[model samples]
Target: MPSQIHTTEAGFELTEDQNCMSELVKLCTDRPELVLFSRPRDYYWEDVSAGEFLAEVYALAKGLVANGVEPGDRVALLSNTRYEWQLVDFAIWAAGAVTVPIYPSSSPHQIEWILEDSGATFAFVEDAHNFADLRAFLLREDGTPPLSGSASRLRRVAVFNEGGIDEVTREGEGVEQSLIDARVAAITHADIASIVYTSGTTGRPKGVALSHGNWMYQTRALVTNPIGAVARPGKRVVTFLPLAHVLQRAVAVALTIHGATQAHWADTSTIALELQRAKPHVVLGVPRVFEKVRNAAYNKAADGSGVGKRVFLEAERAAIAYSKALDKEEGPSFALRMAHRVYDRLVYRKLRDAVGGVAQYGITGGSAMSPELSHFFRGLGLPVYEGYGLTETAAAACVNHKGGQRIGTVGRPVNSYEVRTNDNGEIEFRGPGVFGFYWNNPEATAEAKHDGWFNTGDLGEVDSDGYVRITGRKKDLIVTAGGKNVSPGPLEEIIRQDPLISNALVVGDGKPFVGLLVTLDADELSRWKEARGIPASTSLEELAHNADLRAEVQDTVNLANATVSHAEAIKKFRILNRDLSEQDDEMTPTLKVKRNVVFRRFADDIEALYSR
Candidate 1:
């Protein structure tokens, strides 16, 4: 029988002390000299003291009020992660208005829907490109502006990279600072702070309404929990993930609340250098970032000669064994310890330097991380703590802390939430962190919540120790014609672990047998071909049809098949000429595959797989 309804509540109480603005005030007053934010200048990072940041926030808040933005109005931010994005978010809150964040990569149509749905009055865009996209969306084909009733409420647009701050400051020149302060004081915890739209994979995105109390409670719960150690006063963090995502937004707030210094890197291409320069104590990322690092390490090791390659393989074995021994509470054996010591100096040290020598911990979410990758990192002295939650849960419901961490499981619930599996095996949670409703969508809100518990739509189970292990998405579970229930997540996760494979989708629903659709890691593929003396000019499509490449992928498939029964094994597969991407609408912003979109786009290829 399934286990009894497992429940784990936070061992702490809610902080009834202050709202977000109140906390910011306290931080600025108490630690005025401390650096709160750092933005990149030409070749150096320029610091903004806590006091300075608060002043800027107040100035912008006054600017919004001066421009006729009323309390409870919506202000949208369409941009990549940057210093201005953080400032604008706080300013929106300080102005007693709700923030609506749109992904920079969102299509014009998506931009139109979100702006209209949230009734945004003002918007801040990142660059010229974003400004054009928003402008086109708000105007008609004949080049005329949207008329009265059919138009967006947006009356002003500020371009962040082009004198936007100066314009706002200029607009607020005549407005009294006392006006902005009064608005901030009048705000209550019950007021909505933001409307974060879910990355729509199956249908239109729904705006999740998160109140100030929801974020405040989440920040307090995270800081007081064991994971709070990562947020120590002198610690630093580098944030590059999309701020539109609730996870990054929550982290940004939590860091500010904890008084940790934040370094913003808008250009993700320079993440390596940024890490080295910032030397953050804690790093947060999605599984894709970690996976690429791991794959790159392996590819580099494989490029060596006989002795070097053998040493690298032996070192990996030692690391994995050492990690396993640690998990069992038994120290590494003498031989293994010696091997680890030798390898730590030779192999692991280089890997550590790549992410900056100061990083001691990493937090991964947005998707399930492979256990192999988790263990491998732990072996390198960088313990990656996996967490689980959705946009509706304010980014994190449960997370593994430093003191109580288990590999392959998204640890116990934080101090304010309770997690349990329902009768249908879906994870359900209830807490202050859970959002109250979906903006303007009563039906979705009703379907998503019951009694007081919010259904997470993820299939998972809780161990006796209360660690939750997500099995698969409840909606993505495949039921074959033979009546076998299979989850494609695990199989795909295992396949993607191979250095050459970028992504894999297992499909067998209502079919005779299982099959796969695979995409290659373009970089790794190039390196792979170069190592074998193949010409660099060889096209990816030609390589996909190569006999040798297919056989190598087959080996990965065979390994994945071993994880399941005969009925669930991938019987055949087709290598796609191009990888699924966000631009193609085949993947979500969070890098989740859009299964329905892929199915439609590759209908012919899928049919060809089963034709025989």
Candidate 2:
């Protein structure tokens, strides 16, 4: 038997005295004038220098100290991804407190649970509306306000829209700067930096406790390594992903360390407009964002004239072929090169221009992207690097980056992480980036970790070259009544590539045959209805049963079926009226489906596939 373990040496390490706050402090001292961040104004963006940001952070830290916040206290931040979020986060750290982030979209029950679980006392929210909602939920039955240091220990709630930063700034003015300095000096690499909760795909969310050394080590390695070359001083980055996500937060920390000019964009609906305006050098997104961009381009091409559509189809084929050819010993042929060059001008250029026209490349995670789609993007002179990691790994343990890229695989271990496969083929990792434990959940932590290695629960394979290819979730395996096991991830990835399909959830555990539940893309469906001359007023529920829509979905299912064995193939499918959404509690903040939730919510629908 061959060895299953793959290990990469550590690229960087942290000093004993260094903490997450050290880099910002160093930047302010070394390059006070460097523009560290830019926040959007009414029309243009206003830049903030390193010195200015540090000053504000200190002032906020003083305020935190004045507000009865003690060292090691957990301060909860509930808001969207914006400048204030970063401000409060650093302020909490500077005050020698731990930051606990709650998703802005979280429900009242979730907010209560997280606050109670994390033992947070001070909270910052985004606006008046959110504050009002929070107040309403946390009020006592006797009508007393919860802000009086109630049962949950949450004493105060500040709203950004209500001049919360200014209020805090004013409160700390009388406080001495030496107090802030002393607290900063007291913090070390061993102290906890933040407690980020998991997405809670199954069961309740567990808080992943990451120490300052974990971040300092991981971020230093990221910048010093070849993969993070783009994170140098003066590089512009537009951060739109929620900071509550460990991946986005880690990237933000990495960028801040290198003096990159960061811009915060919270509204996903206007992300394209923001991206175009920022013209960032590197982009970071989830697989869904990239998928939407690809689907949009495909839909546009299809909606054009017949000649144009044919040209696009031919261009796509040429792009994928050219990308694949680059991997071979002999490069792309002269004919293919010529064809690619032509398409680069005709089709690829427009796609690139759609995303700011300046993005060198993109980094995507959260889910696996099909090899075909990855190739198509690379063929357009824009490679989308895919990384694989969990909340436990602090973002990326394996990544396909600049010089070390492999198209289909998430590249070798990063940040000195070691990867291995057990006899059952489940992925395991040990690295500086990995969190030490789950906050107040020792049982869960014990279950997830063995010795120094973290059990990832994800199944994968490691090639001779050390590249890691994720096969599927070990817990998500669907075993049929006949005992044939199938992984739904690959089939779902293929089916979702269809322009009209937004999501595909495969079902058939202990069933006779595989079945599927699919949801249509709202934007694509509207265009499809228009192109086919369907009534504009038709609702999704009405269209779900349409013969034309069903036939189109069946075609995608057929394509998926062709890739797998007969036992694993999807024999039937049902199109849902609406897309799976976070609001419905069917999806996590990271856009991963809550399988148990979906199974319960649509039990009848799932059973209907087999019953008929």
Candidate 3:
């Protein structure tokens, strides 16, 4: 039997004086002129050097200090991923304050809960909309304080669109820079850096307390690990994933530590344009982003001339084949190599050009990625590495890296991390990246971490080669009437690959058979309808019952069914008239479906599958 436990040696030990702030300070001191970040300005990128960024950070830190922010104070930052998000984060640290990031998409109730829970004193909102939401909780329409004590500790709210950064900087003009330095120097590895709340795929979100040491450790681990090969200095990466996401936050730290130039782009709608403009060496995204990229390419080719479509199909097969061959002792044959080279120019080059001609590879997480999609990307000469971790672990506990690539697995434990499967098959982790406790939630903390190990609530297996393959959520396992246990994640991942399907949820718990509820991708459906000669303005309700549409979905379902046993296979499926969205509270900010929320909201739809 394969060993259940997998461990990786620590890349480097942290010094007592080192923290996330110190890392930045060291860079500014050592190489002040080094370009650290690029901010988009009218059509081009404006570079911000280390010294410039540090100076701004200090100015803001002084502003924060002059405004009564004290060491250990929790300051709230409500915004999307942008240059200012990073700016406010470091400035908070420089003032010896803990950051509490609230998603810009968060509801007023959610925002109030986080603010009250974290007891944040000051806050920064990105724009008028965000400010209005925060204002709703802070004051009544009459401009008086709200009745409740929720977030009462919050003293002031700053709006970025209203020149919040400039206001804060100006307020600190009289404060000495030495005070900011002293505050930064006072912070240590054990001091709490941020209280990150979980995305709450299930119930209420809990705040995970991450220390400065946790982030510093990850900064070192990322640059020293195999990933650092391309993530090192001079490389450029675009930051688009919400900074509230721990994965993006940690990656930002790593990029800063390694001197990589980062560009901030909050809007993903123009990701293609941003990618082309940044021309980054590395691209980072969630699984859905990669899925969209692949689907878009395929759909574009399918929509083109028949010859182009055929060439794309051939290129795709060749790529998957070439990737699989690389895994074997005997690599791709001469004929296959020749075919790949030809297709590289004809098909793959365009795919590469779509995401900037310079991208070397991509990193994806936040959910499981189908091996088929991973192999397809790898075949395109742009391998997309997948990693596994949660906000509790500060992003990635284990990640697939260059030269150590594994398609199905999330890869071995990262430096200084130990991963193992308990008797119940739940993945457990212990490492520098792991958090010590949840903010003011000792009971939840005790339940999650025992001795030194953090039970991830996710089930998985560690193969003999030490690769970690996630199976499913331990809490999400479904058992049929026949007592056959099924993990829906793998099947759902496959079903979601079809361009027309936006989301799939598998359900069979205590039922006689498994069933699926699927939502359609609106854009894909529009394109699909156009290609099939359907009316452009066809209503979703009408299309839901369309024979051709049903048949196409059935084909997708059949493909998924073929991959599993009859008991675990989806026996019935229904296409929803609408797609899921974050606004409906059916999806998280990271695009993960809220299973319980979906179950409740779609109870009628789910029941219809069984009643029939």
Candidate 4:
């Protein structure tokens, strides 16, 4: 297939009632006995059938309607990933309202901003901490906080961990179930399904208004594709990514539409334990999750004896070679195959056990994954298919599907989308999956759209086989004084691959040559110290100036520089005493580095690199 516009063949046509609630109704009716959700109770996993799931949604939808929720009303769900989040999301749709997801990590000001901006009438928070934060914002000044032009709209708040759903169900005692059905029936494809707010990297978040048709088209296109068929009936998925993000939200909807079972983890920290219990077939995650797993595996192997370490290294090399042969459609050598089989028993099986021992495929997104990590996973028999999209395009625009995947690129444009790059290298597309508009931001929406195409604000190219490779953010491109446009993202990805490095910021925009500011991974640094017999009492500042550590970082920089042209390569660099983190306002919720913030915070170090 060529890299140009590609569309799906017939027989995969979209349905008439493609709204989310209607699809849920059809799915429940078709597979009432099928287990849709496996939620963890006190000590055991509790299965919720399609029929039971719909029943709960009906009750919650009735509660919402009884509480004065009208069609098109904005309902906020501020919680972590749990079964309740999914229930509230569908319940909001069932009541003919739009769901507004709020990241639980948001500060009080951020929570207030989203609530006021969306004009949400009701909010569901996870626990007492979140409820307290929202209450503080609600009652900021003399029991009446100043809302940003949308205060009067919000009426009630519910806490999910404290019997809130039961209270809501009791409140709807007089409201008939038929009323909820009527609300669902009245919904059309054009109706707004959600107003998902973006995790603003530069400024305040913007709400991307996605219609029912938008999600329906993307969901159908995804579930019906040959690659998507991997998430078929009886397939189990372990989801730990935040539901607030569009990618995970789309995955949840797809699971429901395809009758796949989902097991939710309380947070990322519990993923390994949950995976062991669930033994999921499909895994959905961001790049950071895979990175952490890879790091853990590396650390484990390094902690072993010298002979064990050498054996592990040899096994990894054989696995990589075998994986490459598979990618090239060439058979592995007899010796290499035998070596890999032995390693499979020694090392590969243990790696698989870490991820529940049954993960056939993993879908990663939200950021660019290093090619090294992608190949490493594939070599372990767990191929991770990376996809690309934004909040505006309903999560996935292009993806690596089964049987026709390119390792480095994010595969072809999905069946519902037509993607092309402009003269300026900005990727643009127009498809059914495209969102309707930016909620309450007409000017911003207009600026983002030209003609019928939505500019993705990402720089990339499509290969001959239709695989798209993202180079960098158009806005984050660093043009040097020599007039060379350097993509810092690729360099940063390479630098982060070093176990000692945590995060990296590539600078030198308008400067003589490329420079970088790097931070050390605290855990990896400790491990390195222990291996070298260094005291644990060494401060981060002391380690930053250590001659041995500096030399290792220098090697990492050299490795990264080898990949780019001389003009775009790092000429000078400094290692920071501390790492960038979300709590420090140096990273977005999705772990993307906030370059401007980092630069401003470390102006002295950045200036010093250029001063010399």
RMSD of 4: 2.4
Best by TM-score: 3
**Ordered list by lDDT, greatest first:** 3, 2, 1, 4
Per-candidate TM-scores read 0.96, 0.96, 0.97, 0.95
lDDT of 3 by residue, 1-612 (tens): 323667766457888789989888998888888899999777777999999999999999999998899999999999989999999999999999999999988877788789889988789989999988777556454545575544457778899989999999999999988888888888888999999999878878999999998898776776665458655668888999999999889989788866888999988999998899889888889999999998888888888877777888889899999999999999999999999999999888888898998988898899999998899899989999998889998888988988688899998888888888887888999887799999989999999998789999998989887789999997889998999999999999999999889999999889989999999998889888887899989998788888998899999999999989987889888887789998888888899999999989888888889996
Candidate 1 residue-wise lDDT at 53: 94
The local lDDT score (0 to 100) that residue 37 gets in candidate 1 is 85
Candidate 2 lDDT over 321-376, as tens digits, reads: 99999999999999999999899999999888878898899988898988888999
Which has the higher TM-score value, candidate number 2 or candidate number 4? 2
Compute the lDDT for candidate 1: 0.85
Cα RMSD, each candidate: 2.3, 2.2, 2.0, 2.4
Looking at model 2, the pairs that clash are none
Q: In model 4, what are the clashing residue pairs, if there are any?
A: none
TM-score, structure 4 vs. true: 0.95
Choose 2 or 3, whichever is better by TM-score.
3
Off by over 4 Å in 2: 1-3, 136-151, 225-227
* lDDT at residue 552 of model 2 (Cα atoms): 91
Q: Which stretches of candidate 1 lie over 4 Å from their true place?
A: 1-11, 14-17, 137-151
Using lDDT as the measure, the top candidate is 3
In candidate 4 the C-alpha lDDT for residue 71 amounts to: 98
What lDDT score goes with residue 31 in model 2? 96
